[model samples]
Target: MDMIVQSLRLGEIEIPEEKLIYMERPVLGFEDYKQFCLIEIDEFKPFLWLQSTEKPAVAFLVVNPKIFVSDYKIEINSKEIAELDIENVNSVETYVVVTLSDKIENMTINLQGPILINTENQRGKQLVLVNSDYEVNYKFMTHTVEEETEVNREVPVEV
Candidate 1:
């Protein structure tokens, strides 16, 4: 199952065919792409690239919502669950699209729209959560290391 893909980050690389995830419904803004591969870079653990197979330049940075918000949850309709052929809830894998910025602290995660995948069937769908408390610009990192360190060093002056 050796397949080569022209990736924006890795140039041309070989990937396993089975690793490709089929998107039944296009991701919100990326309706043109129907197939994508989840590439994991060791340097960026808990973060991965959802690279489109149809278009090399199209890619997205995604992460598990639970990493930052432990209570993150998604409720999908039965029709969607049936479309993915998902039987057990454990078979589904969820991820939120992340928008990175020059300033790490300003990075945001799209919680309202989550990409749900049926690992067993290799099928995926980007679902919009209805009436969710989550936001599109949920600050992923509220404080930088320097800021945290500076706060820790602060000492109250004598009253």
Candidate 2:
């Protein structure tokens, strides 16, 4: 089934019902809205829009920590994931909210709180890692764009 969603950023769009994610436990400070959809924009490849279907204006920039921090790992309590009805661990995917700053390098991601979703059932919850050493504001973009682009340009030439 296709549901029409009105988004302030993306405008009105139709998406499959399966794409809708119902929050088992709503996002922090966003309890009123439990339904959201992860929208991926081509220009913003690594980043995604965690947009609230209930409220068009509510959206957050999110990304997988593994993209920048390859060794990013977190331990979640079994009870915390019970609501997601996880029959398989492989169905679970994690995303962290990104905070943008005036400068690109100063951008940060909330590693202490990660939003975990079960792809099978389309249910999700935001977990606060109480005992973890992760910070809420961890610097995400450390390298300059010029440095990465230059390296990419040299890669194909060398190959």
Candidate 3:
């Protein structure tokens, strides 16, 4: 089924259309949050807020693994893919949960657990990186959320 993209809100944050990062699975504890859009309150940085149309109140702060542990990889099972009806890997969007800090730049992402979604079908899943050496919070220093938003506006983020 072709899932329609809808606007979402989290707390006082408004997740824009330009911030969406599609994935292959509609994550657990979030079966309702299928089609999610990602927003970076700070750009060139590692922290972002996730908002799904299915559950507007549901928003998560996430980061990229590349920012922290340079060599992090997540192993997904075939059964999980089949469950989400995922065919192409490109359709999946991955986001690591983030735990904020007093110093925004010091914020860390949860690499040990990652949220994956199939944008094509609006399916999502939050899987544990049990076999990998990843942390719940991986810290990094980069641009502000506003900066990232500006860049995304200039150039569309693909897949």
Q: Model 2 TM-score?
A: 0.87
Q: What overall lDDT, based on C-alpha atoms, would model 1 receive against the true structure?
A: 0.80
RMSD value for candidate 3? 7.1
lDDT of 2 by residue, 1-159 (tens): 998888999999887999999998888999999999999999997789999999999888998776665556766666765788887776778888999999988899998888888889999999887887877988867733333333221101000
Local distance difference test, candidate 3: 0.59
Clashing pairs in 1: none
Off by over 4 Å in 3: 1-36, 39-47, 52-57, 142-159
lDDT values for all models? 0.80, 0.80, 0.59
Q: Quote each prediction's TM-score.
A: 0.87, 0.87, 0.59
Clashing residue pair totals per candidate (backbone < 3 A): 0, 0, 23
lDDT tens digits, residues 45-90, model 3? 4566667656656777766554454445566777777866778877
**Clashes (candidate 2):** 0
